[model samples]
Target: MSAQDYAEISTLMQAYADGLYHADSKALRQVFHPRLAYVCATPGDELHLDLETYTARIDKRTPPSETGDARDDRVLEIKLATPQLAHVTASMALMGRTYLDLLTLQRTPEGWRIVTKVFSYVPMEKS
Candidate 1:
């Protein structure tokens, strides 16, 4: 892949992380595709969310910064399937839990946007 491609992808991923950390709906919208499907599997069942629902949830929450929580986000890997497609693995911490997200990205005329996100949450014991 070209450096430009990598940079574009990296920027979009970073925007996603920042959006979650700050609960910035505009930033989140920029990084995610309008038709995004965010999925999370828990112990008993699975939950699916579309873009509007996800953004609404974010809008209803307090920003992590306001809650005095330190943000932790890392892009673990990005595997390119083709010039127009890639799969990204990333980790982020929220509400004392760590989550690993598998994201599928597509390159559109606007830029790279996350089309699908499947994530798992890891719980932590309280002190």
Candidate 2:
């Protein structure tokens, strides 16, 4: 992939982290494909949500931004297998847990969009 492709994907990842941080559905919509599939399988806890459902749940959450929580969102890696396909892994903290996400993005006519997101999270140990 070219530098432009990498940069665009990086921007998308940042928007995703920020969207969850602020519970901004608008930002999520901008980066996610309409047919997104969100899945989480973590032992006893498993979740599956489509794009719309996921965005709705985010909209209802009390954003960490308002709670004055320390932001810990990081883009761990971005790999482009083809010009049109990319994979991203990110680590972020929300609620009381640390989330590790694997995201699939595709270059589309409109722009780069996240087509699928699978993630797992563990409870953060208190200091």
Q: What 10-residue stretch in candidate 1 is worst by lDDT? A: 38-47
Q: What do the candidate models score in CA lDDT, each in turn?
A: 0.91, 0.90
Pairs of colliding residues, candidate 2: none
Question: Best TM-score goes to which candidate?
Answer: 2
lDDT of 1 by residue, 8-104 (tens): 9899988999899899998899999999999997666489999999999999989997898878899999888999999999999887888999999
lDDT computed for candidate 2? 0.90
Across 41-82, the per-residue lDDT of candidate 2 in tens digits comes to 777889889988998898899999999988899998899988
lDDT of 1 at 98: 89
Which window of 10 residues has the lowest lDDT sum in candidate 2? 40-49
